[model samples]
Target: MNRLTFELRLVLRSRLSAAALLLLLLLSVLAVWSGMREVQRQRQTIERLAPLHERDVAALAARYPDSKDAGNPAYYTFYNTWDPPSGAAFLALGLRDVAPYVLRIRALGLQAQLYEGETFNPEVALPGRFDYAFVLIYLAPLFTIALLHDLVSAERQSGRLRLLLAMPDAGRLWRRRVGLRYALLFACLAVPACVGAALSASGIAATIVVLAVTAACLAFWTGLSLLVATRQWRSVTNATVLMGAWAMLTLVLPALANVALIRAIPVNQGVDLMLAQRQAVHGAWEIPRAETMRRFVAGHPEWKHQADVPGRFHWKWYFAFHQVGDESVAGAARAYRDGLVARQAWTGRLGWLLPGVGAQAVLHRLAGTDLPAQLAYQDAIVAFHREIRHFYYSYLFNDRPFGSADFARRPAFVPHAAAGMPGGTELFALFLLAGAVFAAGVWRLGRLRMHGGE
Candidate 1:
């Protein structure tokens, strides 16, 4: 017990170790605050839109006080749909930083509106937000390297390493030293995160899962540092080699994997679907009215009996053409969505080999801030759009007069429930990888022996 206490005091007394821990704690706090602020902003935006959307609808209702057509209301009134952040979202903003959390869609071709208002540079989103996950995955390892890189090299340089190694309890001493540093680093990162999780009301299970991931990440770094630091090399050389390894794991490999996934998956179908849907909608103007209605009836056989349009222009016929346009590119839309899912799957698979990527995937999945989460939100929007079209179709197909009261009856958007806990596959993989590396490092340290120069 005294030995452990002495080692802890020694680590804290080192200015470098103390400063690194302090900086990491400060960064973690800032990241948590930034993430919470962003989440609040998104919620406020969603809430603000409700009243504004109501105001627009109310004004439109006043314009159509005497009008009986449901087409105008369906065409002009846009319903608000939003995906609220999960309680754990502040830990890792994930794809939410780039994807639209709120959207407004009318009863028009959905493919176009689904991807609209969602513009971001692929490069800009690659680095990710300054959330707790970023701090944990990217910054923590550097600090670990700073503290552990000179563990033995500094003693060797000062001509005490040989004497220390000859000590009867040298192994215990090294273990105590390394263990103390690891605990300190873990505390610096975990304390702020736990506080933030409590404030955000991130469920107990989620908080525990995140903390477990944090431990695995730190273990991996500590292990890697030990593996390198045990070698017979100068402190400067150890620092340089560890920094290079850091770049390889955190930056180079992930970027290369991203490129490979992009080339392999090829999700250009998003733009293709949008253009195809728009072209189909525009081409409807040149096609015969009967032809458009005929195509629409084929898909919606329930409305076949009332498909007749005697006039040159009817609300039913106009809506039928739009519906037909959406159907025209349904194949392309499916392909686009499938491609995105494939990409996300491949990224998850890569997490097995990359600790940084694994930590990120786990955090984002828990926070409901991954590509899969975005895809799920889009699926919800599609379902809601179907409801919207059917509600208006009731009035159009039956020729029922739409009134101000009927506007209130229009379908309201119900967001899907916040994302539930994700699978533990990635977490387990991270544990295995970090555990293996850390074990290897420990083994190497135990095998350390003095050479002539030592």
Candidate 2:
């Protein structure tokens, strides 16, 4: 314990070590605060939209008061659907930055409304947000390199390597030093994260999982740093090599993998489905009204017995064809969603190799802001859209009048429950990689000799 305390003082007294630790702590706190602010902004936006949405609905109701036909009401009324942030969302603002959290849909072909783009600046979003996940995955490793790259090189340069290695318990001494630094680094990250989780009321289980992942990541980088530092090289050379590896792991490889994954799993079917649905909906206008109704009733036998269009337009016919348009490209929609899921699955597999990606996968999954979460929101929208179609169908097929009073009866959109945290497989892969690298590092350290050789 005395020796450990001495080593702690030695590390703290080093200007570089003290500065690196302070910088990491500051960055971690700033990241957590930034993430919290963004989450609060989203909540405020959702809250603000509620009143505005209500006013819009009221104005539409007032405009079409006592309408005899349900078509006008169904065509004009825009219902709002929102996916609120999960409790852990402040830790990692994943796809939420680019994707729309709130969407407006009507009783129309859902595919058209589902892919509507948000109005965020692409330039601003290009580099991604500096959330807690960003800090942990990208910046933490650099801090690790800065602290550990000179662990042995500095001693060798100062002619103390021979004396240090000659000590009776040299291995134990190295362990104490490395372990203290590791603990401090882990604390720097975990403290801010725990505080954020507590404030957000995030689940305890999820927070523990995030902390575990953070520890594993730190372990990997610390191990790698030790492995490099133990090599017979200058400290500057060691730092350069470690920084290059960091860039490849965190930035370059992930970007390449993303490009490769997109190529492997074609998701252009989303755009194709959108265009196809538009054509189907527009093409209906050129076809005879009887032909359109025939096609609509063929799929929907429930309305097959309904009377044909009495005049130029009918609510039932209009809505039925929109349903038909959605159904026409159902296969493409499924393929597009399947492609997205495939990409996510492949990325999870990639985590087994890249600790940085692994951390991202686990954190975003816990936060319910990954691609899977976005897709789950879409699924909820589809379910709610079905409910809407049914509600309007009851009025349209049965020829019941729609009025201002009926506007209040419109079905409200409820987002799906938050997705469960990342599974054990991903967590296990992360720990396994960390443990393997750390063991390798320990083994290399054991082989270090007083002769300034590995």
Candidate 3:
């Protein structure tokens, strides 16, 4: 106990060690604060929109006080759909930084509405926000390298290597030093995260998973640093080598993997689908109305009996063409979504080989803020859009009067359930990679020795 206490004090007494730990702690706190603020802002925005939307709906109802046709109201009326952040969202923010959380859609061509207002850039999501995941996955390892890179070299430079190695039970001494550093690093990260989790009501199980991942990541870096630190090299050389490895593992390789995944998957169908739907809708104006109605009725056979259009212009005919436009690009839209899911699956597979990527995958997934979460939100929107079409269709098909009373019966949007925990395969891959690296590091530490010349 006395020796362990002395080692702890010794580690903290070093200027570099003290500064690194302090900086990590501060960054962790800042990250948590920033994430919480962002999430709160999103919630406030969602809440703020409700009254504004209600006002818009009320005005629309006033405009069409006793209208019989549902066409103009359905076309003009916009419904808002939102995906609220999960309890653990503040920990990772994930795609929420770049993607839309709240969107407004009407009973129009569903595909265009889905992709509208999206200014998506793949690069934006690359350099992530300064959230806890960022601090833990990228910066924390650098700090680990700083503290452990010179663990052995500094003692040798100070001419204590020979004496220290000669001491009885020296292995225990080395273990104590490494273990203390690891614990300090872990605490610096986990303390702020736990507090943030509690504040967010992120749930006990989620907090444990996050802390576990934190420990695993720190252990991995500590082990890797130990491997390099145990070598008969100068402190400068050890730091250089570890920094290079960090760059490759965290930055270069992951970026390359992303490029490869994109090329392999080729998800260029998003733009194609959008354009196709627009063309289909526009082309309907030139084509015979009978052709459009036929296409719509073929898909919606339930409305076949009311498909006849006696007049030159009817709301039923107008809506039917729009529905037909959405159906025109349904296959392409499905392909586009499938492509995105495939890319996400490939990313998960890549996580198995890259600890930085693996840790990120686990954190964002657990927080329900990844690509899959975005896709799930879109799916919910799609479902709601279908409900919207059918609701208006009933009024149009039966030729029933749609008035202020009918406006009250419009379907409200329900946000999808929060993304579930990370898959077993993902968690297993992360732990397996971290554990292997940590074990190798411990094994190398065990074999560490000082030559007589040194």
Name the top TM-score candidate.
3
Clashing residue pairs, backbone N/CA/C < 3 A, model 2: none
List the candidates' TM-scores in order: 0.97, 0.97, 0.97
Q: Superposing all C-alpha atoms, what RMSD in Å does each candidate have to the true structure? A: 1.6, 1.5, 1.6
Indicate whether candidate 1 or candidate 3 has the larger lDDT. Answer: 3
How does candidate 1 fare on TM-score?
Answer: 0.97
lDDT of 1: 0.88
Summarize candidate 1's per-residue lDDT along 262-295 as a digit string, tens digits.
9988887465677777888899989888898899
Q: Cα lDDT for residue 353, model 1?
A: 96
Each model's total of backbone clashes: 0, 0, 0
| Model 2 Cα lDDT, one tens digit per residue, 1-454 | 8888898899899999999999999999999999999999998999999999999989999999998878888998888888899889988899999999889999999998887654467798898889999999999999999989999999999999999999999989888889999999999999999999999999799889889989999999999998999999999999999999999999899999999998888787455677789999999878887888888888788888773887767778788778889988888888888888888999999999999999889999999999888988999999999999989888888889999999999998877876577899999999999999999998898888987667
**Per-model CA lDDT versus the true structure:** 0.88, 0.89, 0.89
Give a tens-digit lDDT track for model 3, residues 309-421: 87578889888998999998888888888899898888999999998898899999999999889889989999999999999999887888888999999999989876578
**Which residue runs of candidate 3 sit more than 4 Å off their true CA positions?**
120-127, 452-454
